[model samples]
Target: MREPVDARRTRILAVVHARGAVKVSALASELEVSMVTLRRDVEELARTGMLRRGHGVVRPMGDTGPTTVPAARGDEPVGEGAAVGLVVPERHSYLYETLHGARTALEEAGARITLHIAPQMAGAERPQVERALAAGVHGLLIAPRWRSAAGEEADYGWLAEVGVPTVMMERRPRPGSVLHAMDTVCSDHWYGIHLAVDHLISLGHRRLVLAARNDSPTARSIRAAFAEIAAARPEVEEWSVVLSSPNAGPGEPGTLEEAPDLTAHLRERGVTGAVLHGDEDALMLVQRLTENGIGVPRDCSVVAYDDVVAALASTSLTAVAPPRAEIGRAAAELLLYRLGRPTGTTGPVRRTELLPRLEVRGSTRALLRPAD
Candidate 1:
């Protein structure tokens, strides 16, 4: 028997209320009705302010938008007109790439974004975030500069008070922390470090030194992952971590006008293979190693992290590449999904991690002989 028009409309309302949003075609298919009939029903419901219409979709009244919605049915621009804020550290090229990726996706979705760069200082993120909030953004995408554990903890109070949907980009709060329940997009740095270590071990490298910065969360995570991976490997005879650059951070090993004597340090311990963090430090260290009579991959094999400029180095460094732009894309996509729900909607939070890949190049090679 044909469902009555009033009955069909009521059912549609129930589905929309439950799902938050529904595509027009999906609603029609579920009701076993034609597009023409569904349109008439939707129009009536919208006229009564019981339903909201979007590009080929329908939502319960008071909904902001749809979450991770598909391209869906008809000829209409798909966008929510939401205003969002983005925060990232200044003078960071890697994160700049992430920012660009997010900007494109949000623009396509018809959302306007306000960008703020937090200078490289402790507690720099909060004030910029306040500005964004004052601007009345509906949501936020932030990559906070958690230079220290205390700095990260300090932001928790204000972040909790933001009172808007937020997504973190490339920053993972420690488990059991207040921000742990927040949404995040991060690179699987542990896996990236494993790839570097595994590659070195496979090439008969027994001794390794990780020259990395203690500056950012990514650098710290890589350092910790390297330590863990290096210790567990039976083939790895010795491993130690050192500062990648002068004035890097955390003030271990102190700064020197002349770069640390990495060549002497490696030779003193009979260490062979080295994994360097970031492009600039790796390039500089590689040059210094050359000047000190250590040929890359010939005297001491090296693997650099952060492929941003690794391949462009003089020796073309073998490096690990975290998915930078993808982190931004996914972060933005998740934030959009968060914005779709009605105000005060509470849902399960997600932590997304994208894996990084190793780019093999001339800087790393098979062991030709024992270290001289």
Candidate 2:
């Protein structure tokens, strides 16, 4: 006698109900079927609003409404029918402005957003997306941890498999990964770096230094772009690039002091111009150089990436302004589009990249001529 598939599914679900929760892998093992097959069943159940899938477990729908709560201390209302999850690395003071800007944009369109703490999605993210999934939000916006592109693919795949549409903010999937098939919203990193480097070079700075995190795809891209442009200039006598080590702990004082130390390492090599990957790092370098008695733009010039106020506050940081607020809005738009809740409309798979703009501020100056 052939057992009916629906009957088997009913029985499987009944067992799940009896247990209150069950892992998908375990269900597949029990049914002697592939995980893919089991996942399809779960998807059907999810589509029908019967259950919600998590990382390793499934929960019954059981009359619980979508997990939308009143505005908490750090959050504001995003409005109706549009529920999105924000998976950020960590909560910093600056994030509030970015999130608020996004909230304002989405609220105007009547979208509601719930912020979740998902630090794993940062540089070395954890497979901890289950809690956000159980909430059964309409969409997800991930600011995934910066790591190998392969890791990025795995994380996105995990989210997609759970039937929630996802968009990555600031990070893109590795090219050729199945997850890369999805859309992303990223800054025009290469062009931004080009402008930053060119601006410093034009200030009579013959030597240039590019500081970046080693092996970072975004950082690597920026470095390669700068290198290409620098290679074309003959007047620039020397240039040096180095990936800063995290080992330079916060406690390390005066590491940049003197011409024979870090600065000297660069000076000995005749490297004067400097471009930094992020404002945070740029400020760090500027402080180090100042501690070493080197004057910015005179002894060295520094440009920051991501024109956050923290970067601009420093007198020596001329920085490229990344559209952080705009990126957040774009990410929200992607999530809404996926949920069939576009701003004043809806659409199919959508993706976009915004160009970054260089803001010349007080930190840069033309090198002074030698005293006659």
Q: What is candidate 2's lDDT per residue for 322-345, written digit by digit as tens?
A: 677887777776665455433333
Q: What lDDT does the true structure give each of the candidates?
A: 0.84, 0.63
TM-scores of the models, in the order given: 0.77, 0.66
Model 1 weakest lDDT span, ten residues long: 71-80
Regions more than 4 Å wrong, model 1: 1-79, 250-259, 370-372
RMSD of 2: 15.5
Q: In candidate 1, which residue pairs get closer than 3 Å at backbone N, Cα or C atoms, i.e. clash?
A: none
Clash count for each candidate, listed in order shown: 0, 12
lDDT of 1 at 238: 93
